[model samples]
Target: MFKNKKFECYLLKNRIPGVVLAVLMTVFMLMMAGRFELFNRLDSKTYRTLNEIESISNPYGSDVKITVDRADYLGYDYFVDSERQGSYYICQQDGRYAILLLKSNDDVVLNYTIKGRMISGGSEYSSIIDGITSDMGIAVAQLETRMYPLIISEVDFPRIYYNMMLLVLIVTVLWSVYVIVRCIYEVSCPWKVRSVRDVLGKRADRQTIRDIDSQLRYEMYYDQYGIAITDKYFVCHGMWHTDVVALDNIETFKKLRTSSNIGSGKKKIYKLLMVDVDGVTYEQDFRSEKDINEALSYLSDDKRVKR
Candidate 1:
């Protein structure tokens, strides 16, 4: 099967474009998955606490005094600004802001700003049902390209969304690999038949043959070579050489039937002839039903044929 047929012709005919498309798609999916994963992790519990802190504190005056026994921000230690001057304490090493969480009037108050839309800007009511549907919709959008501009509105900054994205990323990678391998397989397969002129320096006269139904044909297009029969030997001639099989050494013949273009109007039937001659196995495709029957008649006198 031509899993990569669409691009096979393109790839076989033009290598540059094929390789370029392959590389681009691979890179795009990887970057898309990576970026989405980063945003997804930003919605973790630590960042959730940060978002909550920002939501409560941004509305209050910057001069409001706040105190905290202990607070955690990205696993960093810090205190609320005592001077009512600096809104947050910046860690010297990582530069991550540790927002203050304080208990006031029996309600927790968060006093700092949380940066980035992925962390700060979604509604409070979270539902797994909505999240799944959102993931599917975004995954569909990402099938063609990972460009943020094209899918910005449909995108959701959730772990599930990135999980779906990772699935898409895996599928894209596998499909690309399949396409490349299939294309190589198809291209490397031998051509059906070679021209006589290429194998032989001179052009030979066309031969005539009779079918099993006694129909006469002036010209026959044998794939490899024309056939000639004699009382003592069955001769098959190719462009380069002739193959001679003695009648006494002939063995059983097999006819394998195969079909193509299934379920289509232009479907075709074909038969492969496998012959055993003097312990050597030879196989060839029969051009037509009549040709197959005629070829088998020479090899065996029996009316019955193996299917």
Candidate 2:
């Protein structure tokens, strides 16, 4: 049902990579959402007292929820290069005292420590718990002999899952939207007909329209890179741009060769330099000597060519 079969095929070929990437990212985002939901339902709600949490060997990596009835603020606070990451508190319940590491000073003293009991939410044992307690003179000795320490923070496993899912969801949604927009544009205006119309303007006659359409078809069928050479105009297509220069406006055309260092090797680059009557120079790179020579052959009859 498409008018230009070659242009339609080119659009489909170019869009495949983006479409595949959007699909894969969407699938991965869904998988992470499912995992996050499962973890939130199974792990985050189980709460234990300080004694039970301290009894577990290697509690460092495990996610634990604890209930605290009363806490005495230890004057000591933990900082990493002037930024406070945790605050120290002494929790005493049922004749048991354990050092608690909280995210903020307000979290330790607000409402619960001043008034009644509080359920400290899900927390992972801090890797730096030893460093935090080692410098507190008397409290260090008390923690070593009478009680163990627990590190609690606002960040937990379920939050981590939710954050990751949110990030992937944003990226997948943006990319999918971009791909859909591009597909719509390609279907509506194949062969960049809108660009050609803009270049020719409203008063363009039938012959000019036919010439531009013929040149575009020739470029799609035979042009190796994105360069199109016709008797009336020269067209260059780029990732984000399309340059159309009338043949009559050309001033100078020359071949250029240069050497470039690529990684550990040296490579030769070939290009065509065309300067318009207004002194605007357009340089386009070609893949090889043969390709550049073929493009040059199209301009053999033009008097602007510099040997």
Candidate 3:
């Protein structure tokens, strides 16, 4: 597929834009990686603290303060001691104190106050850890609870950074796949142009460009294609099909200059025969000026041409 000259030309024409986009995407992915690494470390630190608390017999009395690392406030296992002491909830006063209400086995509510504040996870606010500490004199046997401070950070789960990187990756993969598929399709597409009578037949309209006006439409190109001019219309033969432009529809005709620098540093100019149909422009370039004039002469009577 890569050996095909037309596909090679297509790649050459689009290489600059493709490279520029790839570079931009790489930079953005790098930035996202940095953010994930930083926040991931922060979250891991808090999780390690929780692991440490599990080994301690009296975690609630410890001076070590830790914060919630995840976006949700209920980061630590809320039901860690649920089987022993039932369920617990925070009191809703000024929201400064962690007034935990424990529902006892006897259906009695036991209130325990702890010191803490609310923490935010970027957007939503959570009271996950902040600065919670249980009442100092509470017997461990009576409560069977760990009262260590859960100090958590407000920043959690870098969604914007990760989501943008994911989107870019998906787009890049899809675009690369599309380019490959399109190249394959184009390489396989067949093109042919017989005589006007053979292709268009005698019943088709064969008016010259000068006979039509702004309502006429056509398509033409120079790369990897050939031009055939009949008395009725000029046909641009491509891999798929041909576009016929009547001479009567040609509102304007001129030379369109184009250049390419595929080999070495030498600039090569192309002589493009530009024609207008309706408000749209169609153009085809030849290797030399003589060829362009000859192609135009086949479509129009006054073949002096314009530059």
Candidate 4:
């Protein structure tokens, strides 16, 4: 089976896309699995103190509790939208200064536990704090040196991130399974001579089978799809079906050119359109104009193929 050029070509053409997709999905699955394991191992329940924020390693995903006994609102609030907002504050806990971001809501409290993930502050937040400190006539250097200022949100960011990754991983697994199954079906169960003859309503005879087997040896064009021209028949090997038409039954054959915009330029697509005497049309795509032209040249000698 591997030595036959037609079967080998068909196998590779149908299997390569699925194999590539499965490999990519497998890589993504491994990466997501590692991330999920990391998140599962993190300490999400125990709340760390503000003083330990800088000292603790991998504080980005760890839960932290900020006791806001003395908070100076900087009069600046960050708004993602109308529904979501965070107010910045400069808090003092046991002479240690740290930045706190409280989710905007009714019934403000001066003393409460602000619990959430300890996320590093971005440069934009630093710039905003710089302006706030300047307006209040306070030096930024006055803040504690042991613990740098960081943002603390009320939202459970770690849980949300883990859920999003899980959703993507599930989708990738499903797609990988579908591609693998399709590739297996295409390669394992190809269209045999009997199958092609049945599709074309040919009689069950040794001569008919022999003719198809002989024609398959010399494919005019073979890729994901194929077309074979013999002395008396035109055999088309489609992705999911095989069709054989007698040369006398073919009424018309024409080349079609279409152009479509791709980015900043146009890409041309070439196809061969075949119409039988019964007005049944079959269209096959060609990778290039030269390939379509070559296929057309093979049928130019036949009087039945009207071009």
lDDT for every model?
A: 0.38, 0.60, 0.41, 0.63
The alpha-carbon lDDT assigned to residue 244 of candidate 3 equals: 51
TM-score head-to-head 2 vs 3, winner:
2
Give TM-scores for every candidate, taking all chains together and pairing residue i with residue i.
Answer: 0.27, 0.51, 0.35, 0.48
Give per-residue CA lDDT, model 1, range 204-284, as digits (tens): 112211121011122222222246555543445443333334344446567766667657565445454444443555555
Query: Which candidate ranks first by TM-score, i.e. highest?
Result: 2
lDDT score for candidate 1 against the true structure: 0.38
Q: Is candidate 2 or candidate 4 better by lDDT?
A: 4
Is 1 or 2 the stronger prediction by lDDT? Answer: 2
Winner by lDDT between candidate 3 and candidate 1: 3
Residue-level lDDT for 267 in candidate 4: 86
| Better candidate by TM-score, 1 or 3 | 3
- Taking the tens digit of each residue's C-alpha lDDT, what string does model 3 give over 233-263? 5555554334555555566677665668768
lDDT of 2 by residue, 45-103 (tens): 44456667666666665555666766656665666799876666767666666666565
lDDT of 1 at 22: 72
Which numbered prediction scores highest in lDDT against the true structure? 4
Candidate 1 matches the true fold with a TM-score of 0.27
Arranged by TM-score with the best first, the candidates are: 2, 4, 3, 1
